[model samples]
Target: MQACGLDFGTSNTAAALPDGTVLPIAPDTAEPRLFRSVLFFPEDERTTYAGAPAITRYLEDNAGRFIQSVKSFLHSRSFRATQVHGRTWTIEELVAVLLRRVREAAGAQTGAPPEAVILGRPAVFSPEPEADALAEQRLRKAAELAGFTHIQFLIEPIAAALAYEAQLSREELVLVADFGAGTTDLTLMRLGPSRRGRPDRKADVVGSTGVRIGGDRFDAELMRHKLLPRFGAGTTYRVRGLSDKRLPVPQHVMAKLLSWHEMSFIREKSTQELLQLMLESSDKPETAEALYDLVMENLGYRLFRTIEATKVQLSREEEATLDFEEARISLHERITRAEFESFCQPLLTELEQCTQGLLERCAGAGEIDAVFLTGGSSQIPAVRKLYVDRFGEARVRTADAFTSVAEGLGRACVSLVSPDLINS
Candidate 1:
């Protein structure tokens, strides 16, 4: 059976073939492997664009609605449906569109649609059991709608472990840490060359745990601390009734701006009216004007992309500068690695607690031979320090930060269909 593994991540997506080849899907963009998980709907046209084209169209023309991180809304009860270009779309319907694109690209490469697929999913979709169940159901529905006849799921971290295990020649205990745009997942499993062909290896998994905090949270922290303040986040304005009395601008508006999925809500007429009222009563009229222009011109995504790029740059250097000038919002600031680490301290603490909990659950299962890290956020210096501080630096192994899970999932597909092929 021809099959593939799909990693439909929060910020990006990737696919792999059963033979361990990373599928090249994005023919439309320069970055062939990393497909942006974004969609753009033009107001006057019936056509929709995904991946790089979607981002390009959104940046070039402000008339269309740009939706990103659609995977994040799988479990959102409040996000039942949204209207785009006069058509109502449920979250599943939008996700199905993305899935279909991926399937089409993979089919084009292989001359046929995959007969079956191994889909990478988070270990825990939500903290609540019912919500998690609903999230899985929605994902399954989206996969079915995308034209897959058979689908199987593998916990994301576990799949990464499988990819790492393929390099092992002897039995070893491994702990896999996968940090993505939306979540951080950890898994402890026993792996070796011998276990590669096993049909029933459930017992090999010792423990697994996850927390809903990752790259997006860091980007939001950057926005809240550095960017938003320049755009009237904490500035004050006088009450219309009393000239002497002043109240701080509503922080909730800034909160929405920091959020990736909720920024679109600020474009509504009611919010704009409220912003205009706040602008009139503001002590700093210029800041208010910039804030008003920001939402009015629909520049939230562009700002976010700038913030995200800064974060990525900080991961590689000791210092990075954020300079955003668009829609009459001009701001430039220099950020040091120390400051970025300080901003993300609380989240790092949560990640430590989550990993410790998983360790406790896997207690008495001999020493962990190696700790494997994957995902884009894993490249962050502070994030890497978390695992290195716990398990010595020498014990940690890293590979293909973004595509490891998808590659592992593809390996899992081979094991499912032709166990002998994997062994060979």
Candidate 2:
């Protein structure tokens, strides 16, 4: 049996075969072939759903725990486990659930389950070597639990390069930028028809670099600038210790509130108590009340969804309205493209710096023959401009933003076993 290719992304996921066939792991999402990296477990806890079904189920029911961005915590030593429906679920077990579902979905279509797979990963799981190794180890364990006997690792940006190489007839030095939800990874490599099927092409890889920042960080920035103020993140209140002094919410609390997974912790009595304190002491108690109500209603998931929708809309339109109405609170805000870009400027700079780091390993920035952009975040105007500024508009290209890595991983899987092992 041919090895399968798995792209377990932070925001989306996909599975494919060496033959370039992308498995329809998720049939109900906006994009059927690419599944959302989310899970929903009802109060019973025995039954669970993933991808679009998970989101839909969570919306229809409220007593369950819905989790998103599971991939982000893999590198963090602090995020060892989380309470799901009152049961402690480890990071490995949670990831295993997603892996098993992807494999089973592929198995149903491919006659039998595959035992081997090529797993695509980011260039930097974390800057800390120990943390990076631990993240990979956890992923390997999860794959094992998912029933894969043989697993191989491939860098995500390089995988995108392989997918882009299929379109070229001649050799070219290509720079691939994978702007994923949790990380931005880039690779400078030589690829084309002439280089295809070369078993030992390690020499073709010129340089690679990556950074931890990605699309999700930009979303958080937008929330911090445009929406958090409405929820008392920027409002001032009196604390018992600081008798006459007024202070805004602690930076740490505000940080947690911006992240979907971390926001769930707000339901704890300690955090709720803090919010109540703010509500009682703040001059603008409405904002503090909004914050308290948001957490109690388990509405962080919905808020993130609203933020994501506004983000996607901003990619196409000059401005988008963020309208969120739930129990006891209604919010309607209009954010212009300039404001969004301004909010995301820091992250966009970090992304550009990541690309520059990769290019420096080559002779110069102009040494790259072409720039191939992939991932949903690449479509952002500010992100694309940063690349264009360095490589020029004529040198930039794009592939299927979400599936390029999976497609290329499929190609890599095929090459791993083909009879032609040596390049002429």
Candidate 3:
């Protein structure tokens, strides 16, 4: 009768038990215990599979079997994927596989099956009004299919704040900046003492803002601009591809890019599609597999890691160097922190614009109580500095920067079902 909380994100999916420990579900499932979010199918036609083994099989036999970031697909009316035999599958089916994996993981984690579950939903789904309802219905159905008798949708930002509020005092306005794999959401909340005392908590939303960007998009940017250009896919080889000739390079690059999938770069359609297009072209015998391999290594995969590393190194160090020794591309000159800031400036600006819009909405209403910072991207000094600059260090705080929401949802699920076990 344990409750469950799932942070079904675009890049990574995580689940937590009532005891408040969170673990990642392995996508291509390696060891039974290690957690990953990716799910792979043996073939496009085969029912999509889940776990580390599935991922490995897909990488070797059918690289296209992956159905990544289901959370990003929420709200879409249809999800179309090709089976190994070229059969088409619906979005619901894809979701079903993902949900099923969640259930399986949960069942294995705890002896008792989950009676009720809490799932996190994005702030903005489809731009069309009708699409929003479709997204919600799809999610509900997927949850039911996954075996939860009861399911609840919680806003990610709010959930993150609630998780942090557990140990925090309920006296002030707080800001919850949730930078996940796909989107960045800023929620302003005020926590009040629980009326019921079963360790209950109340939260009021002061202002909420969302940006259609996050850590994943940044990886794509790096790959597209910095890494790919070197090998000349869109540039030198307009009809580029992956070939045996390009093996070492593409393999290395793809490995690096795949390594950073946690960044959620695949959500950006233009970039994702472009990368997909490149992959598709490589499928053709006409394109030199070597070229494809080279591009894949030089630009397709390796680029994002370099960019990610640059971003991270720039946070504390004044400069960082990225060298693709295999591909023979190197940014030997010091990449100054200033340069890194400039590179990320646009993303920061977009986030700022979103924040400004939220502020305008709350201008006359009330001030944001506290600024809660969480997520891998939130750890960036550039991002951190921005928040601190706006709301001083005292008002700006980062609690559980990585796993707050998932853990909070776990606790919330337990509380919703069995209030008496509050402290447990």
Please name the candidate that would achieve the greatest lDDT relative to the true structure.
1
- Model 1 C-alpha lDDT per residue in residues 303-407, reported as the tens digit of each score: 888999999999999999999898778988999989989988999999999999989887999999999999999999999999899899999999999889988
What C-alpha lDDT, on a 0 to 100 scale, does residue 303 get in candidate 1? Answer: 85
Model 3 TM-score on a 0 to 1 scale = 0.74
- Please state every model's RMSD to the true fold in angstroms: 2.0, 2.7, 7.4
| True lDDT of residue 390, candidate 3 | 88
Every model's TM-score: 0.96, 0.95, 0.74
Model number with the top TM-score: 1
CA lDDT of each prediction against the hidden true structure: 0.86, 0.84, 0.62
Ranking 1 against 3 by TM-score, winner: 1
Question: After TM-score superposition, what is the CA distance of residue 72 in candidate 2 from its true location, in Å?
Answer: 0.9
Where does candidate 1 stray beyond 4 Å? Answer: 241-245, 417-424
Q: Candidate 3, after superposition: displacement of residue 69 in Å?
A: 2.6
Count clashing residue pairs per candidate: 0, 0, 44
